[model samples]
Target: MVASIALPRLMRIGAGASRLLPEILGQLGLSRPFVVTDPYLVSSGRTDTLLERLASAGARGTIFSETVPDPTVASVEAALAALKAGDFDCVVGFGGGSPMDTAKAVAVLARHGGHMRDYKAPRLQDEPGLPIVAIPTTAGTGSEATRFTIVTDETSDEKMLCIGLAYLPVAALVDYELTLTKPKRLSADTGIDALTHAIEAYVSRKSNLFSDGLALQAMRLIAPNLRRVWTDPSDRAAREAMMLGATQAGIAFSNASVALVHGMSRPIGAHFHVAHGLSNAMLLPVVTAFSAPAAVARYAACARAM
Candidate 1:
């Protein structure tokens, strides 16, 4: 069978790629942008720094910083309200997974005129939404690279997993410098999450040659560096490796797919309000152990790759 791979049209990856956000939007002819982010980034002043850089380029953006840890339909609607209130030309996702996912949702819902539930899998939304520029502040989740997003339904208490090229960012600006300030626990949890994405992508039934190469490379970059970043947050090299590994793992899984751990972990996150990466970390070992028997050789290959 032939495999289809989808990714952002433009990707800028390095220590300070985020500084190019204004240029990216200018190149895309998107003058008016609305930013979707979480309160933490706003409180920490990272959001302000980014806005300041954009202003220097003669671009000012409307900010919606109320995104929650587990983004909800309510939160998405709130963002949509912001999107509708302004004549924004594009959406900027400028924080971790939550803000990125929220931005993706707002981009789609604002155009299609529907609720988040209308686009949940197995709904394939290859049609485009508003142009989105994703700048991930965290090293994990890889939301900037992937063609997927997750938002929860408050009424039903379910994590609605949305898939398709529409959810993918039009452009991704991945800068490891944004992750230097991440706390130790967040560093550890998100590192494990990226590792799990690599392993599952390599082992999934949907795996193919291109995804295999990416997954293995992601594991190679993540395994040794994950611990280093957690122990010494100031280690620039380790942080860069982890950030690149996370993006690779995201590309791997976006082209392939995640297996049991992600499937099981989503429900846990929906019920308990756990962080997406932390929930993945909680279930990675147990789910891998249970599924290993069915694909021993594949699992062994992952072990050797790591």
Candidate 2:
């Protein structure tokens, strides 16, 4: 089957990929960038490296570091206010899915001018947002490349999954070196999230030839290395492999579709405030086991692949 896929015009992956952010911005003629990240990245000095990179090129940036996990509408609002308050010429989404998603929201909303819910799932705002350079600290969600962002509605507790050309990053710097210091549980959760992406993409009713290959190779790379990296946090080889797999799986699922797991997990996350990835993880085994009977041959391949 045929499907639609969108991506960043620029994606830099591998070790030290982040170091090129300055060069990336320079080539694009972007000088004054507003950096969007969470306090965690700020405290951990992840934001510092990015700042240094910009400074190296004599570029200036203002920091907006209040983003929270599973970013909410309120959080995006705060970021948008900050963006407007600062005289930022461009934007940099720096961190994991939450902060990155928040950055995307800020970029889009700043230009588009409206409440987040005003641009919900059924709506696709094609207006280009501010130029956003994405630098992903975690490999999962592939928010750096995809055009989707889930921001929670505090009043209704709905995970408002937003889609549009406005959400796509203009550029991405995916450095595996960043994941080496991540704690084990986060590593496990995001790794499983990547696995879920691959599996869902492979089994999705919307699956296509292009996405199937990405999903297959994603599973091949991630399934083995997930545990290895989880067990030995400092395992560079495993860490690197898992990071690549996570990004690949992100590409796969974004091109195809994540079915029942995401559909059901979103509700659980809304109700229980369980981390989206954890909620998805807890449901995976049971959902797969129950659904395995529907396509025994394909599922057997999945089991073997895992």
Candidate 3:
């Protein structure tokens, strides 16, 4: 079957890829940018690391560090307020999924002038927003590479899954070095989330040759390295593999889509405030067991790939 594949316009991937953000922005012709990130990254000094790199190239930007774990409508609005307060040329989502998703929402809301709920599924937001350059600190979420973003509606307590090409980041800088310091639990959960993405992408109703190839490769990279990184956080090789696996899985799922596990996990995440990757890990085994019968060959392919 013919497949429709979507990806970041510019993907700079390597150990210290984020250091090239300035060059990437230059390529996109975007100068002044507002960085969207969470306070934890700021407290941990990771955000400063990115800023320093950008500053080395004489490109400094404002930061909006109010993004929360599970981004809510209120958080998006807060980011929009920060965005509007600046004369920025672009948005830089400079952390994990929450910040990236928040940046995507903020970019859209700031440009389109409406609530995030208006851009949720059933309403495809294909109209462009401010250009976004995603720099993911975690190996999971792959929000850096995807054309989808999730935001929770505080009043309804529902995680709104916003989809469309408009949400895709214009560029992605994937630096595995950023995840080298991740703790055991975060490494394990995000690794499992990446694994689930590969498996689900390979077996989804939307799967195609392009996605299948990426999914299998992602599984191959992730299966062996997941435990390695968890047990030995200082293992650079394992960490790099996990990082690439996550991005590959993100790309695979972005094009082919996720199925039962993701659908079930989102609601759980909204209600319990569990991290998105952890919630996906929680539902993976159970959901996979239930969905395998209908897609036995595909499931087996994933197993063999792993």
Candidate 4:
């Protein structure tokens, strides 16, 4: 069987890649961008700095900074309202996973005019939406590279998994510099999340040669450096490695699939409000132990790679 692979059309990865957002937008011929982010990034002045850069490059950007953790349907609808209020040509996801997921949901809704639940899993939305440019401030989630978004339905308390090419960002700016100021807890949590992504993708029954290569590489980059970054958040080399590894893990899982850990983790996240990565981290050890017998060589390979 042939494996189908999907990824951002353009990616800028490095120390200051986010600063080149205007350039990426220009390359895509998009001028007006609706920037979606959380309030913390806005209060931190990072959002203003990005908007300033965009303005300097002659791109008009509108901000929507109310995205919540886990990205509720109400929040996505609010963002969609803001998006529809403008003649924006693209959406810019300017923070971690929540903002990115919100941006993806809004982008699709802007074009398709539907509720978030309408795009849930088992319903593949292949049609493209407004272009999305993802600039991830954190080194986890890899939402920038994946064709998936999760939005919670507040009424139902369900974390709706939206899948399709429409949810994928057109361009991604992966910069390790953005992760420098992240706290130790965040570093550890997201770091383990990335490692879990790699391990799960490698052992998944849906794994393919291409995804296996990426997963192995991600594990190699993330495993040794995860603790180093946690120990010294200022370690540029470790941060850079972790950032790249996270993105690779994202691509790996997107192309292949995540296994039991993710399956078990999502409910914990939705029910108890545990952070996504922390939930994954909590479950990975036990999940791996239980799953190893079925994929012994695969688990062994993951151990060696890590």
Candidate achieving the largest TM-score: 4
**In candidate 2, what are the lDDT values of residues 105-184, reduced to their tens digit?**
88888888989999998998778889888888875777887778889998999999888878888898888898898888
lDDT of 1: 0.91
Number of the candidate with higher lDDT, 3 or 4: 4
Q: What is the C-alpha local distance difference test score of each model?
A: 0.91, 0.86, 0.89, 0.93
Runs in model 2 deviating more than 4 A are: none
Estimate the lDDT of model 3.
Answer: 0.89
Task: Mark the regions of model 4 whose C-alpha exceeds 4 Å error after superposition.
Answer: none
Maximum-lDDT candidate: 4
Q: Count of backbone clashes for each model?
A: 0, 0, 0, 0
Assess the local accuracy of residue 293 in candidate 1 as a C-alpha lDDT between 0 and 100: 97
Error of 4 at 48 (Å): 1.3
lDDT of 4 by residue, 151-202 (tens): 9988887888889999889999999999999999999888888899899999
Query: TM-score of every model?
Result: 0.97, 0.96, 0.97, 0.99
Worst 10 residues of 2 by lDDT: 295-304
Model 3 agreement with the true structure over 1-306: per-residue lDDT tens digits = 678888999999888898898899888888788999888889998778778777887787888999888899999898998889879889999888889999998888878897888888988888898998899988888899999999999898999999988889999999999998888988888888889899999999998899889899999999999999989998999989999999999999999999988998999988888877888888888888898899899999888988
Worst lDDT run of 10 residues, candidate 3, spans: 49-58
Number of clashes found in candidate 3: 0
